[model samples]
Target: MAKLTLPPLPYGYAALEPWIDEPTMRVHHDKHHQAYLDNLLKAITGTEFENVPPEKLLAGLGQIPEKIRAAVRNHGGGYVNHNLFWETMAPQAGGAPAGELAKAVGKEFGSFDAFKEKFAAAAAGQFGSGWAWLVVTRAGALAVYSLPNQDNPVTGGDTAILGLDVWEHAYYLKYQNRRAEYIGNWWNVVNWTKVGELYGRARK
Candidate 1:
């Protein structure tokens, strides 16, 4: 049976330090993310989805066996969300994107700063444990939205090019209820290059 595995961080735990903190990264990846992956694995094991890719399984939730569909949606969504979360950030990678990605953002949101304002608002305004995302709509346009819990945009035929986890566990240890502060600081670690790459692929 094929199984989903956790991918190692591209950089050390401390790579995004001073902004995200080392201890948070350690616990987030080792415990939280691992639990999601494990639960996702358990949810699909021995089922027809056992060999299906994460993206396919998530994008086709309606087809999942009814008994384990919820479990698969929550855990599998977490697994994929965390994977993109980690990949879209890096040690010293925060900066504006260039080229086609930049053009798209500018065209969609008027300006990069405008886009940041909208994205940040979405991330901070997400009511509870959920995620805010910059996704490629089915129509191939950029859009910002927030989804509650582990609901991924893929389920709606959208591609998430960038995402921010607003779940308290993602920042409470360090931000201590200051989600706005955490959200602001998170921009420093965003890997625009990676996001641009995802955007380029999603458009195709």
Candidate 2:
């Protein structure tokens, strides 16, 4: 596989502050995300799968050799998941989506408020470390769901347009045990414009 480097955050560590803290972004992106990429590189180096593109790896997991599949699944998913996590957030963002994405949300969940309620519920109700997602299912319908560990929707033939990292590492420093508050505040930093782009791409 071509070497996959960590993508830099679009904004400074402090950009999303007051919603997501500076210290957490620093640790989450620099420490946690970097570790996942490092482990993924180790797992794929010198293997047949080494030449596969990073974007194709997760969807092709079944074809990966058994010895390194678990590493690829966990670490690779973590690496890709965090990439989207960072890209889909920005400073001073938040508010309902517009245009096509807005129509889809309304059509699928009744209204944006209802969608937020369902999405937040999925995020807060996730039993342990996991992610909550707004994904395009195989049939090309919008859906909300959560996955365990570092699992990705791609593995199940769904395309995640928006995702929330509910892992303690993502919010514990600022919100402590209040995951609900973290989930609620997370919307304030959500890059809905980017999410709309992803939704369009997924629909295509």
What TM-scores do the predictions have? Answer: 0.98, 0.97
Best by lDDT: 1
Best-fitting candidate, measured by TM-score?
A: 1
Tens digit of lDDT per residue, candidate 2, span 1-204? 347899999999999989999999999999999999999999998877777865588998898888999999999999999999999999989998999999999999999999999999999999999999999998889999999989999998899888999989999999999999999999999999999999899988
Off by over 4 Å in 1: none
lDDT for model 2:
0.92
- TM-score, candidate 2, is 0.97
lDDT of 1 by residue, 1-204 (tens): 445789999999999999998999999999999999999988888877889988899899999889999988999999999999999999988989988999999999999999999999998899989999999999999999999999999999999999999999999889999999999999999999999999999999
Give the 10-residue window scoring lowest on summed lDDT in candidate 1. Answer: 1-10
**Clashes in model 1: which pairs?**
none
Model 1 residue 126 CA deviation (Å) reads: 0.8
Query: Where does candidate 2 stray beyond 4 Å?
Result: none
